[model samples]
Each structure stands twice: as structure tokens, then as C-alpha cells.
Target: MSQVFKGCCAAFLYGVLLATSLGGLPASAGEGGLYRKAGGIEAYIGFVPAEITQGHAATQADKPMHDGVPRGHHQYHLVAAVFESDSGARISDAMVTAQVSGLALSGPRKAMDPMTIAGTTTYGAYFELPGADLYTIVLTIKRAGATKPVTLKFTYDHRNP
Candidate 1:
């Protein structure tokens, strides 16, 4: 206990055994929990209605739409999303874009392969609106430093569209 306090108590017990062996790892290694339940950059916009309207259900209320959308006075809104990051991490080469407005819709800003989520890299999209209400979605998600491409504006409500 004199060699410089035994080398400062062996470097404080080797930093508490390397922080308890990295806290026993496995919290998905890093950035865990599906990007804090889709409120992070991992992504989580939603939709999936094909029909219901006025009474609501044209996609955006419990994620309907695989058996009911596509009807009426023009109110499609069948968009879907669930993109999470850092699993296999490639997301079809990330350069995604979207800008949906309230509805009275058109097409294409994004529609990625029936909403992907295989293995783990998490990516999804299904945009197919023809009508609905309340929308200000604005996703970007590009790679290369990924500095300013995670903009979310969320406010979807196409009850029965």
C-alpha cells in the first residue's frame, strides 16, 4: 500500500471491472429498444387503410388496410412505416424521402417494397393514399454522416377516412 497507493488501487479496480463487463452487454449492443419505441431516428410513422371513410379507416387508426382500402370520393391514405436503424443497417441504400399532405392525394415520395423489416435492418413504407385527413409527414433518412435527415412531423388521423 505504498507503491503510489498500489497504483491507485489498481486503477480503481480496473474501472470497476470495466464497467461491470460493459453492463453485461446485449442491450442490442447499442441504440436499443427499437429507437425508444419509434420516437427516435429508428422511425415509426404509420397507416394502412383501404376503405371506411367519414366513419374512418382508410389507413391510420390501428393500422388497417390489407383487406379494406381503395374506395370512394378520393381519399386513399394507405401509407405505412416502421423503420429502425443499426441492425444490418443498409435500408435499401438509404436516400428515402416523403412529404405527404393531408389527403386528396397523388403518389410517390416513398413507397419502399411493402414495408421491409426482415432479419433486422428495419425499413418500411407503403404509401397509397387517394384520400384522408390530417397529415404532415416529412421523412428524409439519407446516409453518409446522416446529420440532418431525420426530420419527423407526425400527426396522422385518418380515422375512417
Candidate 2:
């Protein structure tokens, strides 16, 4: 594709992702998911059962090796999508890390790997979120061009949500 076409296509996908993911919510006020805007970057945090990743691997054999679903503790798949708040451009190269704590216990601080989904790039990591407890997820995002990284927190109520 031409350079102009690729730029327009990327911009178009960014807009679509913003519209569908944010769903008109300006910041972190949504019931379906967590979306936070702070320090010039917008972030979304979510998690799914780890089995979903394994299921996909079994069904999709043609997927690229680089896009493999991350595997670790294999309990939950934590995902985060980050973007520049001003331009709505996806931050694919950012260094993303997360720490999950719940019930007075905390998991080891680890880096989240970058993954591409449906032509969009996001960060993900595997964690073991067991039981029906309220979990606090703290995310730290650092970009190469930025002098300081941004840190954000989100609460996930496994019992209620």
C-alpha cells in the first residue's frame, strides 16, 4: 500500500478502536471495562480466562509466531491497550508492566508483552487471579519518547463483575 494510504488506514483503525472501545466514555467511568486517561496517555485494562488463549491456539494455526498469546501462570490473561490522548495513536512500542494485588497479597512485578489483535497492538501478560476477590491492578507505562512513565491503577471486582 502507498504511504498515504497506510497512514489513512491506520488513522481510520485508530478512530474505530477509540469509538468502539471507549463507547463515548471520556475517561474512567464505565461499567463494562476500565479506561483511564492520565499524563497524556489513555489506557484500558481488561482480563479474560486463560483458557481462551489456549483455545485460540488450538483453533488458529495460521497465526504468526510473533503474535502468539502469552503464557505464564495460566490463570488469567491480562490485557492493556494504550494510546496517546491527544492524537489517539496507539502506543505499540511502550514498555508496559503491571502488578496485581488482592487479599493483602501481591504478585511479582512483571513486564507485559506487546500483542497485535485485529490490526491493533496492545500489551498483555498472564496472571493467576484466583477466587472471587477484589483485585487491584496497577499499571506503569513508559514510552521511549517520554521522559517519565505514567502509572495508573484499576480495580477489578471478580465477585461482582
Candidate 3:
């Protein structure tokens, strides 16, 4: 019991130190928050379209090593994270959706289900590209606390060379 208590205390202190270093920004203001600041969801979607295309092409042509495995011709995965705000450490239940155009892909636009974590939940959707090209991605989020739904648009150009 004492060891557990000590571990918890250390974690608490570490969190405090980290928060202080980060201007007291909540941990949720981490990656997802960064994504939001960089044009929010729309900007991220735009970046992904190209990333997926180029990534697929590169994998096919080079047959290069990736993700600790060999490359193959396959559809790229579209992962997304919907957060309330930079300080919103917890991901509330929200209706999140994603869609892509200019690519041939099929999968559930929304995540399997809303996931709850320590203080946040991320909705991730998986998709496969039909062909290599620039694709448009749209994301929409709705939560009870939010007065309006947050929507984002972006494009990606996948190229693997």
C-alpha cells in the first residue's frame, strides 16, 4: 500500500511539474490540441489526403520497410481525434464523423464507438484509398456541452515515390 501511495505521489508531482512547464495547459492540450491550433480538424484533414496518397505510392514503389514491416499496395488509414478544447482533458460523448472524396475507400465513417479515457475520448475512423490522388476529408463533431457542432475540411495528396 505504501509503495502504491508513493507511486501515485510521484505521478502527481510529475504532472504538476509538466503542467507548470507547459504554462499550466492541460495534457489534452497535447497532440490533439496542437492539431486544432494548426487549422483545427480541417487543416489536419487537408494534410492527411496528401500524406495518404504519397505514403501509399512510396510503399508500393520502394517496397520499403515501414511500421516495422515490409511495404505493400494497400489503402491508407485515416485516423482522427476529436477533442472539446485545448484544456478539455476529457473527451465527452460526441457525434463525430469523417468522409473523404477523390479516393476509393470504404469503412465506417465514424469510429466503432466513443471511447472514454482518463479524461478524454478519441474517435478514429479507418479508411482505404481507392487510388493515388488528392482527396478531401471532412470532419464533424457534436457534443452536448457544445452549442454548435465543430466542422473541419482538409485535403491530402498521397504519393509514394
Candidate 4:
């Protein structure tokens, strides 16, 4: 009955609809082309060239938010859209972090910034790929009211892509 509750319901339904329509989309839709469903969550991830984020920075109204994107060689923009496995509700408020590692190389954990687009919120951040062999992208998601965090692992074979 409350406006807030109604709005959230609408958004949840929209997310469900979007998830259902995923089959029609190309696997390489976001250039990075990655999707996975595990631990009762469906994660759609895209890791592309960081240069694309420069365009986003130009459109940002806040100067501080613009510099959040890191710069480095073989850097890529990682965007992740996570949803409830059954309800299709988008989880926007979760604290998302991603760590990139391959072979003996590993980096510190970096928190993902929430980016809202068309009324939908997703998580993203910049990371180095270095054209390194196969890199494992491990995402740790912590949601409010949930006792344990959800972890998702994805493999990025930079050479093939």
C-alpha cells in the first residue's frame, strides 16, 4: 500500500522480465561476455576496455565520482548485475567487491561502485587484466540483513577474448 513498497515491487518485476529476456541477447553483448548463476543468484558480468569509462566520467556531475575509475595497462571496466535467483529482484544495496588474480599474481580487494542506469543499479570498477593468462574474477557480495556474504567466481581468459 505504501508508495515505497509499490515502487520496489515494480522494480523487482522489471528485473524478472529482464532476466527472462536474457536468452535473446548475445553472449558477447557487453563485450566482456560473462554470465553465471550460482548460490541462488544470477550474475551478469561484463569486463571491457577501461577507455569506455572515460566517456562516463565526462557525463558525471560530481568530480570526485569521476576519479574512482583506476588507470593502468590492460585495464578493463567490470560491471556486474546481480539478481535473486527465483524472484528476479535486483540487489542494489549490497556491498560488492571484486578481486583479480591469475597464477601467482593477485591484487588487493577493491570495492565495486554502484552505478544506476535507467532506474536500475549495478556494480562496477576498473581492474587490470594485463593480457595475463587466465584470470579469476572473484566477486564478494554482502547484503544487509544477510548474515553471510555470497561469493561468485568467474574466469576471464584474456587471450581468447
Candidate 5:
């Protein structure tokens, strides 16, 4: 087989192994978290507090806030990953962005940064929450080789926090 095919197979196996080791699929799968397929690519999206992301980062350092976001605002990181739906191979070459809106608040669509954890590539962006309210997160993913972008929307309840 060709080297590219071999690589894809390896990546597929890695994804399966990782999922198994984690005990099951991500909670996002059941929580209205964005999981969709288009143009042969499957996208998985999630959001978490910036503090949680900082804790996960190997550097363990806080990220600087964007100039416009006010201090003390609740900050969150949007995380996304793409995979080949058929083969389960992870796709790292993609342009990802997200917009958040709710409670009369709307955030700019921010470009996501690619991050690798345990050999898996995930894209993320940071956005600020104005207060404890319900928010809708929209993710747009343009995967390499795909003709059109895929959009995923999900509601996040921040009222409790």
C-alpha cells in the first residue's frame, strides 16, 4: 500500500485506541455538542472555560485576553476537531472559527488555533461571556479538500455558573 494510505490507517487506529482508553465517546456527543459530517469530514466541537484550557496546556500559563474583552469577564475556549468519517482518521488541515451570541450579546467570529494533545489535533478560540446566561455557539469549519464549509450550532447554558 502507499505511504499515505498507511498513514491514514495508523491515524484511524490511534483515534479508536484513544476513544477506547478514554472509556467512551466524549460527553459532547450527547450534550448537543456539535458533531456533524460534510464533504467526507466529521467535525467535533466543544467549549470549556479558559481556565480549564490553561490547566490542560502543557505550558500551564494563562493566555492573554483580546484587547476588547473586559477584565473579569467569564472567558471560554471553543475547541474543535475534524476526522474522516469513514476511516476515523483525524484531519488537521482545516480553517475553524466560532461566533457566540445570546442575551443581547454577540461576539466576533474568531479564528481558532490548532493544538495537539496526545497526537490529536484540536482547534480552539477564546471568547468572553458577559454574564450568567444562555449562549449559542456556532462553529464554521472549512476542511481541506472540502468544497463547502460546515456549520454547527449548539446552545450552552451558563446560568448555573
Candidate 6:
């Protein structure tokens, strides 16, 4: 093959490899599964079973329900962190609210508690899952210096569990 043709082919292969590698990286806005970016801020959310948050008990029946959560329902812990979109600086002053709902039932929107964990400020709240159903979680964030609130929605299907 000619030298110029060989050079072009190598460049093409390199470009393909680069593109494929980059595609695997997280997106700027929705990089991680529970990440979203809006109104110049990035938010990360995590959900954990009540057992993990409250500690494991000898039996599932021994687990206590979080305040205000009804009995016979399983509680899920929600944790969130906000960051500046451009600088990636942790944002601790933003007001965060989580609205949890399901196709069968919708709960009231509640304010999440803000706390510092391991030097990082995070917001947390507990939601109840009555049974196997599809649930929708919507987070509304109001950050300082931002005119509008950022809203992000995530869905969870607990049909099997």
C-alpha cells in the first residue's frame, strides 16, 4: 500500500478506537445511572434498602419503620449530592426535595435532610415501598444564584422484589 494510504488507514483506525472508548464514558449530564445535570448543577442520587441504612436485624420482621412511614411497607433510603456543573464543586446550600410516587399510590413530596458525611454534604430521605410495583422518584433542586429549579425523575420497578 502507498505511504499516504497507509497513514490515512491508521488515522481512521485510531479515530474509530477513540470514539468507541469515549462512548463508554459517562455523559456530562447523565454520566452515572443516578446522575443528572440541570440549572448549572449536577445531582447524584443513591437508593438503599432500609436494612442497610438501619443495620441488619435477625429477621426482616424485626426491622423498624422510619418515622411517618406506614407499617407493612418497606423503607428505602435516598441519598443525594449536588455539585456545580462547570467547576464540579460540591454544593451544600441548595434546597432539595424528593417526590416519591407509584402507579398504584402517590405519596406527598417531602424535604430531604441535609447532612455532612465524610466531608461531603448530602441530602437524604426515606421512602416507603408498599409492595411490588413501579415507582417514580422526582427530585427538585433549587440552588443559590440559579433562577429556576432543576427537576430530575428516576423510575424503579420492584415487581420482582
Best by TM-score: 4
Tell me which of candidates 2 and 6 scores higher on TM-score. 2
TM-score of 3: 0.46
lDDT of 6 at 135: 78
Which lDDT tens digits does candidate 1 get at residues 1-161?
Answer: 48666655644453343234322223233442212223334444444332322122223346632333345545443332334444523234566566676655433565333322222222334355444466566666665556665565555666464
The list of candidate 2 runs beyond 4 A from truth reads 1-33, 55-74
Best by the lDDT measure: 2
Clashes of 4: 0
Which regions in candidate 1 have their CA more than 4 angstroms from the true location?
1-40, 44-67, 88-134, 138-161
Deviation from native of the Cα of residue 65 in model 2, angstroms: 7.9
Write the residue-wise lDDT of candidate 6 on 1-161 in tens digits: 88666655644553343234322323356453567776677776766555444321111245332343333448776777777778877778888999888885777688886655444566767778777887777889887777888998777676876
List where candidate 3 sits over 4 angstroms from the true fold: 1-34, 37-73, 86-90, 103-112, 116-120
Predictions in order: lDDT: 0.42, 0.70, 0.44, 0.68, 0.62, 0.64
- Candidate 3 CA-lDDT value: 0.44
TM-score for each model: 0.24, 0.69, 0.46, 0.71, 0.65, 0.65
Query: Candidate 5: misplaced stretches above 4 Å?
Result: 1-31, 37-39, 55-71
Ranking by lDDT: 2, 4, 6, 5, 3, 1
Compose the digit string of candidate 2's lDDT tens values, residues 81-151.
88888887778889999998886887667788776565667777777776789888889999997899999
Candidate with the larger lDDT of 1 and 6: 6
Which residue pairs clash within candidate 5?
Answer: none
- Write model 5 residue lDDT over 103-159, tens digit each, in one string: 667768888776665666777667787688888877777876777887777677788
2 or 6, which is superior by lDDT?
Answer: 2
Which candidate would rank higher by lDDT, 1 or 5? 5
Which has the better TM-score: candidate 1, or candidate 4?
A: 4
Task: Pick the winner on TM-score between candidates 2 and 3.
Answer: 2
Clashing residue pairs in candidate 4 are: none
